[model samples]
Target: MLDACYDTSVVQSAVDLANTLKPVRGEDFLESVGQLHDFLDDHPALGPVKPSEPAEQHAAGARWSLTEEDLAEVRSVRETVRAVLERASTDAAGAVALVNDGLRRSRATPVLRVGDGGWRTEVVSGTDRCSAHLAAAMFGALASVIATLGPNRLGACAGPNCRGTFVDLSRNGSKQYCTRACAHRVSVAAYRSRNNPG
Candidate 1:
């Protein structure tokens, strides 16, 4: 089990990485090395996060140097993370297996670090490969969510034509759509259908 106060930003980073390739739109935002760099820039939590107190840090992987190989490997990790999000609600056991296998391949190790603020746990890879670091951070975050909350908290959006993945961190855990816009769009469409039944 991971820390009870797992970093939600890391969990969101996993979802953001998985959502970079939109299945319903058939659009891939992470197709190039530059895009991969952009992703790293946007989600710094996916990279080697520097602990506030380095002496207490157990492990922090190497800095990312993006490449074609790195892009390919990160995309592969994305597939596994996406699969977990899409399947966890229905097949919790299968999702657990996917996360476990990916974490094993990435050599993910969870470390408890004492920072200026307090103590927190982070997952890091043993190698310098950017993809492995990403896999460790993202897959480990998903695993933490499954262990903390139920596996059903991770899922795909219910909005029509949108396959966006998300972790339902809400207190009630009733999230069906990825965003407020998606939920409102769906609600309005249903209302229109009821009013203009023809």
Candidate 2:
């Protein structure tokens, strides 16, 4: 199981944006316009985040709609986020610079609210619509990850056949593969190598 520490919606949204760009078996999910829309449909946060939509407007208007322009904007942001993640894997300073630039562009501010658990902090974003909403949420998460976990935790998989990037939300920093399936495949290969001995 993934560590629950980075299990917030913001983090997951960021992860989804990065994952869509990273290839898996020669297939990239956001490679086309149709696919991009499909990705939005599949992802909860990126689709239609109605943070303050009115109930009556929802009946008469399509407030939760995505335009073609929105898709392009999101794809652009996805690329930027992916670059930052890739940099974080090897160049912490570069990653920080990139994420800082993203935060500035997003114009997201931290707001505190009292909750049942305790006082909680949230990014009160200036962007309150489709692609911009996704971008802002992703950057907010990136900022938190860089500050708390450090940028080194953002990385692409080392598995020979995998191209997915993962946030290291583990209790210990033992995770190198993106998924358990990838880890198992590597383990099986190692076992075979030891037992067979070419």
- Winning model by TM-score: 1
lDDT of 2: 0.67
**Which portions of model 1 show Cα errors greater than 4 Å?**
1-4, 49-62
Off by over 4 Å in 2: 1-7, 31-63, 114-116
Query: Each model's TM-score?
Result: 0.90, 0.79
Weakest lDDT window of 10 consecutive positions for candidate 1: 53-62
Whole-model Cα lDDT of every candidate shown, in order: 0.83, 0.67
Tens-digit per-residue lDDT, 1-198, candidate 2: 222222266676677778876465655677666666566555554323433432131221134455677777777888878888777868988888877777777665655544445555555356765556666667777777777777777887888878677777656766688889988999999999999999
Q: Pick the candidate with the highest lDDT.
A: 1
Clashes of each: 0, 0
Instruction: Write the residue-wise lDDT of candidate 1 on 72-184 in tens digits.
Output: 99899999999999999999999999999999998888888765558788888877678887888888888888988889999999999999999999888999998899999
